[model samples]
Target: MKVLVYWAAVVVALALVAAAGGGQVAMAAVRCSPAELSSCASAITTASPPSRLCCRKLREQKPCLCNYLKNPTLGKFVNTPNARKVAAACRTPFPKC
Candidate 1:
């Protein structure tokens, strides 16, 4: 569990870096890895409020959200009502995708 959360945080971070839009430099730094969103899994899967870490990662990964939503493997999870609640709790806007 800890390991998963750790990986998820990393993913969100990468997405954040990419969204930062530093041009090529930023793109290189961006990861957009879905694994990084692991930290939010528990909150999104359960009724628990999102943790600070989860919220932070959600913010960081905000740019990659649309891609995640478009992904067949991950779209379902990202589109869930629970996921929306988690996003709301974290103050991260849910992607239109």
Candidate 2:
């Protein structure tokens, strides 16, 4: 469908923009879903390097890090040293929350 194609294009564009630069994507329409962090999970749980997608998602989700930390279920995971390392690697600085 046209709508699906358009949305897919938008996603690809956003990803491309994110991968090509650092900091926020300048799109406040960012989805605040914590599940987006899944891209960084393997790196967060181990010593592996974060993929481009992982860094992109982390940058996109920077605005929501405090909220994620406020979540009891996600708090523990977000607070780990490994998680911080992943964020640092992504250049997505771990929030002070």
Q: Residue by residue across 19-92, what tens digits does model 1's lDDT show?
A: 65421132335656665677777777666898898898888778877777775646766788988999998888
In model 2, which regions exceed 4 Å deviation?
Answer: 1-27
C-alpha RMSD values across all candidates: 6.7, 10.6
Query: Candidates' TM-scores?
Result: 0.69, 0.69
Tens digits of lDDT, candidate 2, 1-97:
5645553554455455335542133347875666667677667666589999999999988887887677665566678888888889888878986
Which window of 10 residues has the lowest lDDT sum in candidate 2? Answer: 17-26
Off by over 4 Å in 1: 1-29
Checking candidate 2 for backbone clashes, the offending pairs are none
Instruction: Tell me how many residue pairs clash in candidate 1.
Output: 3
Error of 1 at 71 (Å): 0.6
